[model samples]
Target: MLKVAIVGYGGIAKGPHTSAWKKIENAKVVAACDIRPERLDLAKSAFSSNIGLYEDYKEMIDKEKPDIVDICTPNYLHSPIAVYALEKGAHVICEKPDAISVEDALKMQAAKEASGKVLMTIRNNRYSAGSQYLKHLVTSGQAGEIYSGRCGWIRKRGIPGKGGWFTTKAQSGGGPLIDLGVHMIDLAIYLMGNPKAVSVTGNTYSKFADNTEKADSSHATFGQAKEDGIYDVEDLAMGFVKFDNGSCLQIEFSWASNIKRETRFVQLRGTKKGLEFRDGIIDVFDGGRNTKRARIKHNVDARKLDTGIAKVLNGHEANIRHFVDVITKGVEPVFTIEQGVDMIKILSGIYESAQTGKEVLL
Candidate 1:
């Protein structure tokens, strides 16, 4: 069995990652490390008292020498921890955005290349039922030439961790563009045939920094909230990305906006048909019949898919399973270190564009 170690024992590590580890037959979490004593204790309880717990990730990695390292830490720590784990000769699976900056992402890529081990960041959205079906259509040429797309994850009132790291620029990068944009943006790019983004133009806003309204999104409870901590990041970000293939994507991400409701969606325009993925449902619209001038629509509901599992698995679990398969079964990885670097470049360009009020070349 592959011995696994987790770097952060927080909500994401404790919840989805933990559930995924349990479902994977060839791997087991033998250790967990966290800076918080309370969180370490919680990890111990969940993994059983026999599991190793440490305050420092380096010490945990050195002592345990685990085969796999799962990183679910804050955005800033992702690159460092992943590099350290990769250098230690362990395959790594990390949470999203890859890293906060291009330099840090390159560092992780170098480590992975040096170690010659798997380094897969979580792109959980691609594992969703709707996404898989859409990918099938795209690869099979049924979706035709996907040239343009729009994607976003907008929340009515869901600034996570309020004045904590989620709102802090230094720790969490540049807010919703990094936090929520990664999800839909990556999905859109993936479905659009993994196009290399060439340029980006963006704008950011931080109007909800001091607002005391209660969060309406369950996502708000992700991290520890502070009464009066730093809130230096943007609450909303809108951007446009142009790819080398001549395709383009329009994106919007907001943690707390005055929208009608919370929604996560991606719409891709293809030559044959247009795909609309909203709130886990996919709708394909064939523009019109040549003779009748009537439109045809096909709706695919992800919730109704027969996944052949004991229970419905979220994208995280499916992604984790894929990671294990890649390591143990020599399965080709859907996510790569180079792709991660490209993703970071796009995000960093958007942030730069937001600041300079000009298009940033990636």
Candidate 2:
């Protein structure tokens, strides 16, 4: 049996990660760690009553000696914790953005190499039903030669953890660009055949730091919001990326912006047909002039694509299952540490470009 211990018993680790572990055979959550005593209680409620809980991650890892260390902590702690876990002979599966900076990401990659242990980050978006269909379209020569794409997750007013780690640059990296950007950006690039991002140019804004508006988005309740916390990170970020394969991606992410309701989408322009995944559904557009017709467009789902419906619809749960499979059953990994490093490099480059007001080459 593979023993798994999770760091940061937050909403994600408690809800999706633990729940998925319950459903997976031969893998058990042996322990959980968090700084907050309340969170440890919550973890106990979520997991077994006999499950070990710790306030210090190092102490937990040292004592438990878990085979797997799942990290769902704040952005800044990802690298340090992952490195320590890997060195202590534990496979690591971390939540998104990989690491806050390129340097930290590289450290994780190096540790994984030296330890000879698996390291996978949560690219949960890739496991979504729509995302799976899109992947089929791209790989099956339907969405041929994906050339350009546009992806974004924008919110009119949905800043999470107003004055907490989510708002602090040092703790959570930079606002939506790192928090939410990793989701859509990684999905887009994965669908686009994981093209190498060569250069990036971007801009960031912090307009709604003190707005104190009631959030209409369900996502606003993710992190605990403080009364008067630091809101130093950007609320909005726009960027463009040029891939090595000549394909480019345009991205925009905002925790708060003066726009319509919350929407998350990914659109790709391909030679044969274009693909768009907005909200949850996917649609394919065929601009080929057949007869005197203008264009052809149709909705596509897992049923139509014949891809087996996932037992776990939640992408987070499915991703966790995949992580378990890769470790216990020797299944090939879909997410790699190298990709995590590249993802951090792209995000960090965009932030640097946002500051320097110039394109940053990767």
Tens digit of per-residue lDDT, candidate 2, span 269-355: 999888888887676888864312112123334444543323355688778888878877787877888788888888999999988
Q: Candidate 1, which segments miss by more than 4 Å at Cα?
A: 289-312
Query: Residue 152, candidate 1: how far off, in angstroms?
Result: 0.1
TM-score of 2: 0.94
- Model 1 gets an lDDT of 0.87
Per-prediction TM-score to the true structure, in the order listed: 0.94, 0.94
Residues 1-362, model 1: lDDT tens digits: 99999998998998999988988889988999999999989888887789999999999999999999999999999999999999999999999979999999999999999999999999998887668777776877887999999999999988889888878888998788999888899999988989999999999999998899899899999888899999999888998999999999999999999989999999999998788888867777888643111121244444444332112337899888888888888877888788889988998998888889999988
C-alpha lDDT (0 to 100) for residue 204 of candidate 2: 94
